[model samples]
Target: IDGEQINLSIWDTAGQEEYDRLRTLSYPGTDVFMFCFSVVKPDSFDNLRDKWLPEIRQHCPEAILMLVGCKNDLRFTLFNKFQNQERKFVTSDEGEYMAAVLGAHGYFEVPSFHHSKVAPIFHEGAREALRRRR
Candidate 1:
């Protein structure tokens, strides 16, 4: 990234079970794998260790992995809206702990529609890929 032009391609299949078979076909040449889950959805975070991490590792065992908690902006909003009801949101501490347990390269909690926030995830990915290239 330091004076070098890097073309980073991102594929977000959104983990639709209907395309599970087809989705993994694109995993072969992936340099970085960002296993993302919604911060507002504890189930999605649980799926990371139960589903995603295993699937990606099966295909790309030594992949440079990052755990991303998406829709962070909604965490508080959803909690307030559903304040009377019981709900569980994935905490930043849990995300960080999971990343450490998974041996991920990094972990991020990001708001939707913020390019300033999103860019660093890819930037780190690009830098890691570049370093590995050398």
Candidate 2:
């Protein structure tokens, strides 16, 4: 990150109800919380507010929060296929707006399958964590 080497460890527990207690245990040393949702699923975006954010705030209040819209490729594909129908996917503008509303450190739309494209998310996250530490 910015010519410095950063050691980052990520614990992605995407709201597993059965391991809610176990998940909270990993929150102690967390520097950044990447709250991710599918762009195709509006309900998942809602979960960021209805479920994830509150939990993260409760456990790690000072942690840097990032709003990530996953499966962005699917959003474009689905939208093209359903062009004549009603568009149900969440828009990029909406994701950015939510990030602002939640006071997230960053907002990213990524296709999980592509490692090259996904690298920025972690790089930016590490940069933010380093910035916060200073």
Candidate 3:
């Protein structure tokens, strides 16, 4: 992006149990793995440790892993309007700690509609991929 054009191809795996075996087929050439979870959905974050991390490690141990907390806007909205609601939203501290525990290269929070916020995550992933090549 800094005066250079990078071509990136992304493969999004289905979260369905039926696709679990098929997902590993695309792991071989993956440059970076963006393990994303919604801040508003605590179960998705739990899956990172319970499901995704083990699968990724088994298939692509050398891949650069980045942990992303999505739906930041939802979390903020809920916080402002319904602070006492019995809902769980992930905090930046929790994301950072999990990233550390999972050996992720970085942790980021991104709102769904904020395209600008997502760019740096991919940029970092691409940079890490390139750095690993060297």
Candidate 4:
């Protein structure tokens, strides 16, 4: 995505039921996926895995799903409510763990504090994964 042009399909799955049929269509050929949530939201890694992840795995068995906790500006919100007090930066530990279970490559995080920083992380991660696969 830097100087080269590569076709990338990034799907934002709606939690709504209406998209259930459509979601199945994307199950295949999904090399990587980024599941994003706001850091300010009252959720933790375990909670996220329980509520949202199983369905994603069911749909995209081949896709590497990356759990991304976004919004870097909400430190107080993250610590105060979510109780992920030690989560100051992003890591792919959870991502890789899930990936291992699901036969995927791995996972990572991106702070949505600035679009500029977040954009490259996704593109670069995807590109690198693709390269390694080849």
Candidate 5:
């Protein structure tokens, strides 16, 4: 991106059980893996460990892994609304801790609805992929 044109093909796999077999087929040429989960949904984070990470490790062990916490804007809006109502929102500390535990190359908290916030994550990911290629 910094004067060099980088082409990145991203495949977002379906978490449904039916797509498990087909998802593995997309792993062969993967340069980097963005393992994303919603900060609003704890179950999604659990799946990152129990499902996504293990599957990616099995298929593309050398791929650079980036841990992304999605819907970050919700942490302020929806999450704060539920704070005293018995709901738990994932903190940045927790996300960073998990990323460290899983050996992720980068960690980002992005709001899906905000393009400005999301762009840097992909740009950085492309840079990481390019670095690894050399």
Candidate 6:
């Protein structure tokens, strides 16, 4: 690890229609932004992404974005509701594609992998930030 101090200020913005107008201003100095989405949404990943991330890019053009799929623990729960691997794969692929389009640093699929925890996501995101700052 490099000897460097990293200060991260995370401004969590809610995904809401009411906040739509502020999206452009919400991102400016953000070093890394997490674009998190639930695995449970019935909409296609592309559809959701098309509706959401363009605004983010418009605002936070230089931020290192990470497209995250939340609720990994619920995968099995959704297995019965949808085609097991097919839909999941499509959504994930769409996220990856969107990430590429938006100049994101990476894509993360996190769902309580360790004792129902999400530390890895934080750690990795921090690493990205620190690495960039250095």
CA lDDT, every model vs. true structure: 0.90, 0.89, 0.90, 0.60, 0.88, 0.67
Using lDDT as the yardstick, the better of models 1 and 6 is: 1
**Residue lDDT tens for model 5, 1-95:** 88899788878889999999998898898988998899999899889889989999999999889999999888889856777787877889999
lDDT of 6: 0.67
Instruction: Report the C-alpha lDDT of model 6 over 1-134, residue by residue, as the tens digit.
Output: 24655675667776677887786576767777787776666463554457656776677666677778776667666776776456543356666777788677777676745533465766678888777776
Find the number of clashing residue pairs for candidate 1.
Answer: 0
Question: What is the per-residue lDDT of model 3 for residues 37-56, given as tens digits with 9 covering 90 to 100?
Answer: 99988999999999999999
Residue 91 shift from truth in candidate 3, angstroms: 0.5
Model 1 residue runs over 4 Å out of place are none
lDDT (Cα, tens digit) per residue for candidate 2, span 20-102 = 88889889989998888999999999999888889989999999999989999998799889999987998899999999999
Candidate that would win on TM-score: 5
Q: Rank the candidates by TM-score, best first.
A: 5, 3, 1, 2, 6, 4
Cα RMSD of predicted structure 2: 1.5
lDDT of 5 at 43: 91
Q: Give the TM-score of candidate 1.
A: 0.91
Error of 4 at 97 (Å): 8.4
Q: For residue 69, what is the lDDT in candidate 2?
A: 93
Cα lDDT for residue 15, candidate 3: 80
Ranking by lDDT: 3, 1, 2, 5, 6, 4
lDDT of 3: 0.90
Error of 3 at 30 (Å): 0.9
lDDT of 2: 0.89
Measured against the true structure, the TM-scores of the candidates, in listed sequence, are 0.91, 0.91, 0.92, 0.63, 0.94, 0.70
**Global lDDT for candidate 1?**
0.90
Stretches of candidate 6 exceeding 4 Å from the true structure: 1-3, 42-44, 81-98, 112-117
